[model samples]
Target: MSGGAMLSLDGVHAVYGRKIRALRGVSLEVRAGEVVALIGNNGAGKTTLMKTIAGLLAPEKGRVTFQGRALSGLPPHEVMRMGLSLVPEGRRIFPRLTVMENLEMGAYSRAHGAELAREYEHVFTLFPVLGRRRAQLGGTLSGGEQQMLAMGRALMAAPKLLMLDEPSMGLAPVVVDKIFEIIARINQEGVTVLLVEQNARRALKAAARAYVLETGEIVSAGDSASLLRDPAVQKAYLGL
Candidate 1:
């Protein structure tokens, strides 16, 4: 991994409506080529953090910097253009679209040419099942397959940083394992990952460094091994 911050959130605070605070002075960094995990319970603002970083929600306070440029006021499309892509929670794939069409939607920013074709081939290689089901509607696939399609669509964008939120949610244990394996492969292929997952044990195992977020704030932060061994973390998150 490179010794530089690929994405950084400095004292970011966000709210909903008018007074509902979702994040409080949340600050963290994801270095290039590293898989960083953010683990927390439901209602801990994990999704909020993902959306905030993706430019889906502008922070009320603090700064978001990506690739050394400020991202505070940039729109979501602009953020994607800058090499940041988010595969949001719940595997939000278009049910009506064919697998190939969904993947095409992801590369909307790219020119329709050889490069785009190569991207499709790349995603197909990553998930061979997607290639087989290219003509099938996304909704017709199994849950696990839909998840793969969502990830493949994101890969079509060829992002430098890929942020995944709860990619393992609602899947069988075997499917979850496959998802993590793909995540590792993606990291090895050089996309820095910022992951938010509820499966604490799995998330810790997958990430190099991790931050424990609780009640809209960071309660702990360290390398995965250290956090896994932490007594408090074990009792509350790891079920040890």
Candidate 2:
């Protein structure tokens, strides 16, 4: 609702196959340098909202703005150049490419050289195992490693806002903990994050502010700590 929003969606509505509506007047915002979370059950349009913002799926109505620029019809590549990047639900790495190659692909919008090299070093610092396996094929990395690679690759682009979809999906508990920690550290380094995670408790813990989506609309929103303690949110999402 404020002009200082780093990313804002105003009454966005998206449809699929001319029949199903995935987003119904959804509106939310992530301010500069903040970690925000969107938590919901399956088919709640979490991914669709992320796609709309990333330009993977165009909204049939309403507007998406990043840094005061409207992004309704921009293509995904153009959105990336505007300093917004999305790491989709799965760890969609270039399976055949080596780890280093995958990281290079993240910076496709930029020319190769000193700046890219600096980003590479920063990614390696965040996930040292990735640095160790720089030559390994992406497909061969373990699940946790692949998740790390996904985040690292996105970071390679040096985005101002990074949207992560289910960063903890299908991973062991310990690995999920590590992944959330890395996310926090990434935010500490000045990258604003909008995370969509099914793991509500962990998502709330990692984010400062949060929104709870139900059937394609934001049903509730507040600071993460308060939502964590909310009776309805606890029973429905937190499984308490």
Candidate 3:
């Protein structure tokens, strides 16, 4: 692993069922305190890669290391305990749970007391609306609010590496902007973010580095500015 890399995936491969291949020799690194974007089309194995890293799925080949610790055979809960949290796609907040309940679920592995209370305050500070609606059922919130709640829930874990998948999907343009703004703010506060997003343009703008995935493999990767300017990337992803 590189000295500064907080997360590293080396030639990783994952499959589904038995025959369906999802990731193909994927390799990437998320450096400490950097927001690295993974942009890809609908079926491009982006989520697969995220799941693999989070220990939701075991890779068939290669290695996944976080903070220099091998994560290959660990379970999801163990991975979470190691300071890696994933806010999965679809803002999967518990509909029946109140906002506060959902956030508490995120901290299940954490100790009870002052530290846990501080995490709640921290999340509320980031999304004051959540604080205001702490008693409301999560299902009652709007799409944007639900997204915020999901992010806040993940933050409750105090993760050093936060992986966000498709955070802006199915939201209005203005809402998307707000989401990205918060993402930048989170990164600035020292979280190493690995963001998988469908809105390639917004992802590139928010990220310092980016990788392009296609059909389960990485097709391009570079500094965000260079990737944004590449003719192929512009034409295929940026709609320019």
Candidate 4:
């Protein structure tokens, strides 16, 4: 029960240094085995929302509830340990560490003998490139491969809810396709997903529901299929 409807942000407001407002009463939710995308343009508070859910930045107002528990004041590591993980916009991998080491770092809180072995096998299965380059330093991998490593490392946490921010930014079309395919596969295996993407077309296709954020507020939200076809959403986000 706790793993499903995995996270919720209700009437959340986030500010910076008491002057700039980053999020204005934002609200969203993610359910089990579903991919929910939040779409927005630049400076729309997408990254801020992700950081809030991950507990890196606490909301100035409103509630962040995960699995029926209040999440305010919880730290990022605590949130991760509770099965929420984030694969951030920029691939943040330890360049000096080997691919295997990076994956191990993802599991640092709970990595053990058999558990680690299973985690390694599972992550490798998901991102075979990581397995192939297991010995290579993370910094040496190509951009796409680094993205894979970032995702694989996130998976190493055995997260119940995975939040992906700007997953398609700067990747080639083919690499983007591959990443989306993996995201679909991950969802099929029952990991709830909270996806933040600027590529609205691809994201709307993958998610079951979508929310469009602008100037730190949600302008639209509905079933993904409907939102994809909405005249306003099409005009504003899809360029259709």
- Top lDDT: which candidate number? 2
lDDT of 2 by residue, 4-111 (tens): 899999999999667889999999999999999999999999999999999999999999999999999999999999999999999899999999999989988888
Local distance difference test, per candidate? 0.93, 0.95, 0.94, 0.89
lDDT of 3 by residue, 170-227 (tens): 9999999988999999999999899999999999999999999998899999999999
Which ranges in model 3 have alpha carbons more than 4 Å from their true place?
none
Prediction-by-prediction clash tally: 0, 0, 0, 0
lDDT of 4 by residue, 158-207 (tens): 89989998988889999999999999999988899999999999999999
Model 2 accuracy (lDDT, Cα): 0.95
- Best to worst by TM-score, what's the order? 2, 3, 1, 4
Indicate whether candidate 2 or candidate 4 has the larger TM-score: 2
Model 1: per-residue Cα lDDT over 101-132, one tens digit each: 99999998887889888889888888999999
Candidate 3 Cα RMSD (Å): 1.0
Worst window of 10 by summed lDDT in candidate 3: 13-22
Better of 1 and 2 by lDDT: 2
lDDT, candidate 1, equals: 0.93
Displacement of residue 136 (Cα, Å) in model 3 is: 1.2
- Per-model TM-score, in order, reads 0.97, 0.98, 0.97, 0.95
Clashing residue pairs, backbone N/CA/C < 3 A, model 1 = none
